[model samples]
Target: MPSAEAPAAAAMDGEQRLHPWSWLFVLLQQLRQFVLPLVALLVFGGGGGREAQWQALAAAIAMVVLVAVSLLQFFTYRYRVGADGVTIRSGWLQRNLREIPFNRIHNVTLHQSLLHRVFGVAEVRLESAGGNKPEAQMRVLGLAAAQALEDVIRHGGSDRAGRTPDAAEPADVPLLALDTADVLRLGFISNRGMIVVAVAFSALWQIFPERVASRWVEQHAQQLLGYATSMHLGVLSTVAAVGSLITFGLLLTRVLSMLLALTQFHGFRLHEQPQRLTVERGLLARLRTSVSRRRIQSWTLQEGWLQRCLRRRNLRIDTAVAETGNRSDARALKELAPIATPDACDALIQHLLPHAQWPMPAWSPLSASMRWRLLLPTVLVLLVLSVPAWLQAGPWGLCIWLWLPWAIYGAWQQTRRAGYAVDTALVAVRGGWWARYWRFAEIDKLQALRLSHSPLDRRCGTASLWLDTAGASNMQPPLRIRFMPEVQAQALYRQLSAALAARRLRW
Candidate 1:
């Protein structure tokens, strides 16, 4: 129970083993990965009487085997904290040693669940650029030891620096803090609850017996119909009932989303240190992570219609932290600002990228004929869709043509709002109509620039410019400017290429 400094100092010398209880955590981690299969086994494999008892015993044996394996791992895993980096050696039958340099580490994450906190232990993960998995994962370390290790890595642990692990450093500058209100706004703006529901439904479909599920649904449907018949309900009453049910479902999802937000960002705080940025959050499970400021590769400012109406926006960044096999890595590294006012978001940008000039005055519009170019595709799609509707409904199907006006409006609005901005330090593209976003990157971060013209674009005398950055997320919109005049697109591409050539890529 010593301070973080004590463990850090201790770790700096010879090789060290994990906390004694590390196996417990390792067991739990393994269980989590196979939880579904285990549950299915318990429910389906276990028959009544002796069969159930035998199945239960088998499951217990499996758990005991897992525990034994975890213990073996704990006994085998050893790490050494040196001046330059940490060397991890692990294996039972076959020995494996990995040396992770501090300078190459892109992300240092510490996680503590409720149980881990009770045990005064934490899990540590180290990630580097372009790696498919975490460079190192320490299952259980003393809370202090984990922080000390994180601090050492953050401060550059090379031997030549001759730096003390516990040396006092610059105070963390407050960047952004989320209050209950901010979390609520984020919950309302996000569709996480719906996603959770969909996932739950999918899981049930996979795990639940189809006959049982169908029987339950049939019983409920029959009861509802009987009740309606007894009440002599008309179409209006049925419609009202359905409307109420839909409203309730929506409310339930929103409430779930809010609860999720509360747990995830209960005490979310982003802070800036001398060399890196740090974030700490969560209610039941605490997460603390840091990424070097220079490691950020691209920035995104997003505002859906809901966010816009709520007067909030989400600011995200792509970091050099590689996309890892761990799903949680994406959630941890992507969000820079989950929810904030426009002005606050801009302030954060200004503080982080002082050279780039946070708020570019005005974005240059795309080609004047961009609307026509956009509309052409919409017209073709609608024409195809209208045929189906007309075939089905005959005269009534012609009403599908009415959708053209909305499509036209959408195309025009998108063209009007979509544009690109360039300055000495940054290149940004703005796009989307209802769900708008701005993607920008420092000129130096440009990995590649492509200027290409489609057949349609060529006929329209326009081109598209694609910008690529390291570690960019495919889920997010790309930094691409479409329907720009061919000459301007080519010029911008050349300018960005020159910028990339002149600078050394930092990340």
Candidate 2:
């Protein structure tokens, strides 16, 4: 039998079709993308039993067509990695061939779905600069084959340090590995549950037939009110009931969040080479992505109220080029450390970027004027709305006043969290109350810096600072330090300029 490395080298030079098992992957991919439309066609097709029968028949035909198409795609798609670069030939009707040169090839990502994992194959994606999509994607290949191809494309060899990937003596070292506890923290730290909820609600809305909108909402509201009224609830009882429901909803949402976290971050591991960081994660769909450490544009350290209470933080990395040149790829590549204790984060950052500070020192507050700027408007609006509410609902209207304090408290907390710091090598900013984040960009990656005061800020003699970089993490809002003392903003801007001028630009 040929040795593992030999086959890898040969595979790199030779054109090949996707692994046979890819048909299943292709089919699943199609079904997942179009399942909603198919569902809608059946649910709202509106022909009663006859229509249902026709819809079923149509769905069956569609499935057959999809299966056949997947088979054709698997057969037609061919890829090769060579000294020149990577080339792909796909499409059944009009041949669509793509060739990406090695230098132009931005990155190679390896992902494995549950189905692919079962078959011992992984997906390989090749990305190029300046696009929202990958240049080429191989839905299924043997895990070894994927790594081997990546090796040839990246290192110009079929093995690492003269050792085949299957060999045990590769030079790459493990940087970090999340244990069960750390993974659990990720579930709590993740705010993706809201996004999931929004998507689920969107699907549900699509599933609901159109004409039922007004009647359905009214009917459900009446039923809920009737049930609540039937209970003859007093203020305390109503409060308790509502509180219980709210708690349950929150718990359910958290549980959903936890599930997503587990599915996405299972068995997460990080490894480092001299020039790149490689991350491998997931249970259902495993993914391995590598990025050059130097390409990182910025770092974000985030802490929500829950994460803060738990003493945990999330670290995200922003890179110049999108990993696979798409949103999904961005999600997979940006998470530097999903959730870790502060100590672990410190270790990770020190190891990852030695010169960059994690929890910075000598932070300058955004200025106290921000407090009144945030609070005054809210107070005025509350007062404006409260009088009419009081007129209509009497005592119930006065109850709205209770929210004023909560709003003020939130605004105050934001002001407290707002700050900025500049060091010789980094420019950092802090904000966000419920979902607090600290973002710092390397002076080397600094693209542009601007300082502007809003009309409100002008009256208060405060300005907002915005810094631009090659790329910023989605989880981290754009670099905007709002409501800082105008002079401080200008000072930071100048400091950043000097620092940037002195350093070799990374981008």
For candidate 2, the C-alpha RMSD (Å) to the true structure equals 4.3
TM-score of each: 0.93, 0.83
Clashing pairs in 1: none
Model 1 lDDT tens row, 277-321: 888888888888888988999999999999989889999999876
Best by TM-score: 1
lDDT for 372 in candidate 1 is 88
* Model 1 regions lying over 4 Å from their true place: 1-7, 46-61, 158-161, 164-168, 458-460, 473-475
Model 2 over residues 156-266: C-alpha lDDT tens digits? Answer: 343422445555535777877888777767776666787899888777777777566557878999999999999899999999999999989877877787888888888
